[model samples]
Target: RTVTLYAPASGIVLEKKVMQGQAITAGEELYTIADLSDVWVDAPLREADAGVVATGTSAILDFNSYPGHPFSGRVSYVYPTLGEQSRTVRARITVPNPNRLLKPGMYATVRLNTSAQSALAVPQSAVVQTGDRAIVFIDVGSGRLVPRAVTVGRSGSDYVEVLTGLKGGDRVVTSAQFLIDSESNLGEAMGAMSGMGTSPQGKK
Candidate 1:
């Protein structure tokens, strides 16, 4: 009996080797198949940046073909090996390509957001980042702006998660944070401290 081989997955026919009724072997070259349900962006992250990339980390993928649109995904796989020349590890983020807008060869930009899981969060403008350290200007009593060191986590478009420096009720300056940041000398003051700092009363 003649056997008919079926296409593996749904995809546009890239190239067909044999026409209908042509003799084909069991292991003969068949049509290539691909699905857009799961797509990956080979984001090369520096060795330093690899620390922030872990499993389940959220990532935003943007494609030039579809401008002004972002597809949400997660860090599904992190390569164990790093590029010899670039010294950058390949972080594979899985994106949902429902409409097949993202093709295999299409180039795209990936934004990896890695930060605090659950903690007091504030506007992104409220925190000042200095290399490895993060500082925030807390509004103390009597129109006072106090500088405190905090461990920051994933930053959203408008907000950032405070890992340790803040609590639920603390009031922080959201707008014009640069003004307070400049005046407070926060970098020098909080730079010496550990992850979290305390108030004058010694309360976190």
Candidate 2:
């Protein structure tokens, strides 16, 4: 039995490879059309950063063709293979283009919004970095500042997740974290030196 492949849908011929009666075979792609509605973007991410990426992650797509306009999309599929030269994985995201404003080969910036949860978080200004650890000053009461170490997780521009060493409803000194950090360091140093007159085993 012989079958003919008709144009999928009637639209302007974006690319025509065969003429009216050119020989064609089944399952052969001969023509391409430009349907700006419902487009796909090959969002790329570094291989090292692929751990946090997963399907269904919300994303915002920005196209150079339509400046100042952002389209919403989601992580449809993540390519398993990595680019040999760039060592980057191209995660495929589908965006609805009902306005037909997006075109093929246009540059796009894909932004991923991670999971949201009710975790103990503090203002960005409340955290201070001391070498590899993060420290924050908590206002216990009566203008007392208590310095403590905290484990942090995913952070946004205004808030940082406090993974440990903090609980909900704890008031943190955000404006004076740096000053508190200096005080904590001075206190620790004094304590360490105070026992210097003792044996080394006592210091430990």
Cα lDDT for residue 130, candidate 2: 63
The per-model lDDT (C-alpha) reads: 0.73, 0.71
Candidate 1: which stretches are off by over 4 Å?
A: 8-15, 116-204
Candidate 2, superposed: residue stretches over 4 Å from native: 1-53, 78-92, 96-116, 180-204
lDDT of 2 by residue, 49-129 (tens): 576789888899878777788999988899889899997888888888877677777898778886755678788887877
Alpha carbon RMSD to native, model 1: 8.6
What's the TM for model 2? 0.53
- The alpha-carbon lDDT assigned to residue 169 of candidate 2 equals 84
Cα shift from native, residue 44, model 2 (Å): 7.5
Q: What shift in Å separates residue 186 of candidate 1 from its native position after superposition?
A: 30
Q: Name the top lDDT candidate.
A: 1
Per-residue lDDT of candidate 1, residues 55-167 (tens digit) = 89999988888889988999989999989999789988888888777788888888888784445688887776767777776777665556667887555568777778788
